[model samples]
Target: MSIFKDFLLKFRESFKGTKPVIHSVLGNVFSMRVIGNKTHGDLAEIALTEYINEFVEDYSAVHTGKEKFRAKKFEEDISVTNKLTGATFPISIKTYGVGPLQLSTNKDGSMFSHLTEIVSKSEITNSQKIKDILKNPCFFNFSKVNVLPLIYDEKNKTFKIILFDLEKAYNSVSKVTYFPPRKYGKDRETFPIYKFFTADEQYIFEVRYGGAGANALQRGMWTHTENASPFFNEILNGTYQINEPLIKLVSKILVSPREKHEKILDLLRQLNGNS
Candidate 1:
């Protein structure tokens, strides 16, 4: 098994102490398969708010249900407050497939215009430009933004809830590139996408300029969970794994390639030995 598979398997031992109510909430979440993605996302927000209150220690969660007032005032779906310290955390909840996940939406063209201006005026490196833009208060408020992504991996038929450390990610960024709308595809002439990278040139995320006119509502920042996963190993230890069928064990053994199969066996041995 690759490092990623090993990491996931270790965390897959089933989360303990989960509230029973959460199981029912998750059931409702899965039942929304026929619903639109937007409705699905709304349900995920409610589920996540409840999940945080149940599992996370020292935090009280409040659901900021789709109110236009809160949307304009806050950038997060859930507001978490530390019970002891009274510190507050603004969390954005996203429900997405294993593909690219949007980190934040750019309803207006301000983010795009700001970035373009920086690129034109600043002689700094792409990373510096990103850091600079983030520092601007005119951009997305709250420097310490936290993302709670509920990712559904279609291939594994599993759901994973993990934290995308946007704060740490900002520092890790080493490059940022702009991709204007392609001549082909649905995005053609609709919007532009900005790709972010780490020091090693690993892709971190993208700022998608949602299309023009009615489509403009689609704008947001995005990232692939596969690419963003490694940046947050410590957070991964607390991942909530769900939807895996019992048959996965036998199916994996039968379908995995020989090399990967052997690696899985080796990892199992190591786990057993440690136990």
Candidate 2:
């Protein structure tokens, strides 16, 4: 190659090295708390899928969390494809604050019913019950279930991203203890909750049995991000840290008058050869 071509290539490589660690940041500039939980979650699902397509190497993503795809019992929000290997997998995206994170819901209450029977059976010991419960396919319906948690640390005012396999989580538990609703306390466990812990007593996660009726939706496996980060870290290497997203400008633009945005829209159309 020519000396000029070699120098140009080196310059491009050096510039690439200086790129920021976080390619895309997801979160609201204002309080994400102001937005309804479900709305923010849907937005986060789309944002993360786009981020993967744009930034993650050799990967393409498609959003699949719409009502049309509700047939998916696994609750997968997006499907990601490995371009090189031609492998694709579904991921359930969860958006939550730095607190007790709901991992998965008791969809159709099958898991709840199964666990209730297991817990009440007098023939099996508690240890054996837990072992049997974990062995159940209801907890793990598939060979691989991927979960991507986008945690917003309200205290630190930052966001964290982690993609982990749910099967690893099931295997990490060493013990399970049940906590029933308290009779006296103002702030008590409203329902019976089964807490899972690792061998060293690290809180892994919990399964809340929130009644058998309308509250069945609330009955889900929960985990504190800080407590469960270690398990997640081991699964997908680690988490990615991102600062608060620059959403003020985007929000302003969205809420601005149509007349004010007309010029910009025209320019965009012209750039796209639509004008």
Candidate 3:
């Protein structure tokens, strides 16, 4: 190759690669900076799914008074059994973070929406027990509910865990209903979830819609990992207001929704005129 070409090739190689900017934002003014995962912390709802048990166990020694503790974790919550009472009641936890609340009530993946779709067309919806449960459909039936609050602060680089009882936190929900664009892809409208609390609860989170989150409906539940990192503000010593969520999907109430849905979905195998 020519000397000039060789020089050009070597120079191009040096500029060919650069570390990827994992996150970026620009508005009002002109400025640019490269950022890493360190900037955008893991949103709390995400932290709950990813590290609920770990953080809970991390703080359990400091918080609860129960004994012979055995635990189990599912999507967004945990159950600590007071072995003395044989109760594996679920307690909720979350890392303080940003983004939308995303406990979908009637969305596709949601247990109730999925079941509602199934039962509406099936015969088992006729079962007395099932009928009684669906008659109200209030709060959309969920399991082992209690709320425990937690804060994962980016500044301190630590998780400040707080415990809460959903049983006492003003058990109420908005029951929002709306249809999504074709992109969301469901014949029915969606219902995002929200669990509220009285002043006594440790934390509260809210999404001020107008940005991307508004475009995609969210607020309330452990939605995704992308939103886990949150800004933490301390009030009353680890007592901040969190938009608390009640663990509505009680296994005792729904009789194992996963199993129930699975069995019922087996229409060829589970259906008959009267059996």
Candidate 4:
């Protein structure tokens, strides 16, 4: 009997004999089906798909086209700019959800070390050109890097940015990689199944599972954005033009709901008719 077959046999016997044997055959079977054959590529595709779906659902629920705001990361705020009167008000969008795993391997350290070596050489030689090259975003590259800066728009006098954190994100899924069994013995091709010990000897199987690695967090964030970009562009840019007049109306309605309700309603009706 093969090692796997023997393992199954033992598991089957355990379930047959006693009621309190803590039968895990079903659990083991289910685990194997889901994670047993997964590859790194498979997990990545799944993660990316889920990240996009969740982002779109969450974003639409919170942002209604009625508000005119620009998102900015540098100052950590979304600013509503009044186009008509040229006034600006700061606003913020907060997202709560599951975040990705944060892990790093030796490979990441090696790349960083190499870049540091180059930077050190450039500094010692007093090469301003080399230093400038090193300072460029493309030159100082990594597998995962986050550049979140407050962008200034002097033309419009507005800043907009979004901050999102996923809720219960990790528990979304589990995965494992697959590996074939190894062969040994003189007649490995025809080795008897019973050669695998059953009675006294115990066997163990260890499988590495989960997309747990460095850059997982950044990858997850990228996945979410890639999924959401289409919808955001469509709704914000394509469907509705967020202008100064809209921002002022939204701000007024927020402060004076009773007085502005009818006027706001009228404006929306007209806007809809134009559309």
Candidate 5:
């Protein structure tokens, strides 16, 4: 018999020789289990297939030659723009799996040296050739590049450049690694590092973090708020008066001298007390 068939026979025999009816009952249970496993596997495959198809279709639509905006690549930066809004933004995307490398470390420096050696060995020697070599999307060094946020002004048609500060952002992220496997020396040989390295990892960097990190969130939020801000400003612009009868009454209760704007101070005090 084939090795697979022999293995199945051994698995089947493990539940046998109890009683005649018991063996039959256990065989039925085993059959049901196998069928259920196959059904679940098939369903998962179908669902994955559907998701891939939908994603490909959506991607093609967004990236079609006639699409309004497309990703632009400069010497070392990438800028994504909205063709209709005249808004342009620069974004730096980086990976986290590769741990931070210190500038002074020999091992880190050697890695770059190794890369330089490989590039030098290549036939092309011109600046354009060097640019083409660096353009390979796979080779990303986390220690070298940091993600920076770019803001766009719809009114002025200009991009705002901001520095990235990632100080407290890493603290907020849950350090959970999915599908943890038992640690074994041989396991390293089987692990697919390339596949895992390609997967996109999400991190949260809030507004208060400051620098490049803060810029990242600020740029994204500003891009979203640009259209809504004018409408909101119009509705709320004339609602308050400098010296209104009703405003003076509320201002006395909540406004303090240290605060610059009385109207804003009262609102803040109310929110602070409520929270």
Candidate 6:
């Protein structure tokens, strides 16, 4: 059996902690329908985290939060803990099904890319959860982290990512996040009145930090994502708009040439063995 399949098949047996719903994207196709509804997202998540814990020096996998957060702990889509520096941050993945919308504001001359969120409520309210972590001394192990953003295109099968220093970005650009909280029954119209993420400045972001060869926002090792349009800060007075599109980006991950899957499987095994 392929290493990926071996790990996945052993997922329930090896890791019996959290349950992140699996999803995937193989080249152009968003998600490949195998069983009823299962993809490599969750499986990859666990395998990657385990690999991080095992092989990736200076970093550990932190997918869950404090106990009080309750159902909110699992809000994190991807988090990396710097074992050496004792820092950690999360990468928030946002999907746009109908591609991305370019909104030009009439009030102010500004062009913003708008997208709908196809994730859980906790995904948006992560700031509150982060706030909780920031307050807890236990999380001091992860003293620093960048709240990175990844934009996945559903129709076009592409991704536009923004890697910003959450602290600096917040202080510099004007930001506006409105994904509702996890407090049950919060409809689409429900706005996150509490703490959220947006920009406060318009400075140029030094996109100097280039690709991780692999982006773990698959967010860790053995992962090289495709169809991505990564951007750093550009001169901007207007903000990027976000709205619910008819089609959301919630596709699955599927690779072609079959061997690609085997390659990932091999990488996973190598990492697992190292860990």
| Most TM-score-accurate candidate | 2
TM-scores, all candidates, are 0.65, 0.70, 0.29, 0.18, 0.16, 0.31
Q: Which ranges in model 2 have alpha carbons more than 4 Å from their true place? A: 1-24, 27-38, 121-129, 163-168, 183-189, 210-217, 234-275
Model 6 Cα lDDT, one tens digit per residue, 123-242:
333455435433443222222322323334444444443333233433332332323324556553222221223343233121111123312111111101221112232111111222
Better of 3 and 5 by TM-score: 3
Question: Per-residue CA lDDT of candidate 3, range 39-60, in tens?
Answer: 2222333333333233222221
- For candidate 4, write residues 1-275 as lDDT tens digits: 32222322332343343342122211221122223333222222232223222322211111212123223312112223333344433322221111211211122233233334443222222345334433444323321222111111223433222221211111121211123224667645221110111122221111111122334222111212322222111111001122345345445667886757877668866975632
> Which 10-residue window in model 3 sums to the lowest lDDT?
23-32
lDDT of 2 by residue, 18-85 (tens): 44323233534114455444666777777767666655666678999678457876768888777776
TM-score of 2: 0.70
Across 74-178, the per-residue lDDT of candidate 5 in tens digits comes to 211233333344443332322111112111112123323333444322332344433343333312332233233222232332322223322222222222122
Error in Å for residue 13 of model 2: 15
Clashes of each: 1, 0, 31, 17, 8, 22
Candidate 2 lDDT at 232 equals 60
Better of 1 and 2 by lDDT: 2
TM-score of 4: 0.18
Ranking by TM-score: 2, 1, 6, 3, 4, 5
For residue 15, model 2's alpha carbon misses the true position, in angstroms, by 15
- True-vs-predicted CA distance for residue 166, candidate 4, Å: 19
lDDT of 4 at 262: 76
- What is the clash count of model 4? 17
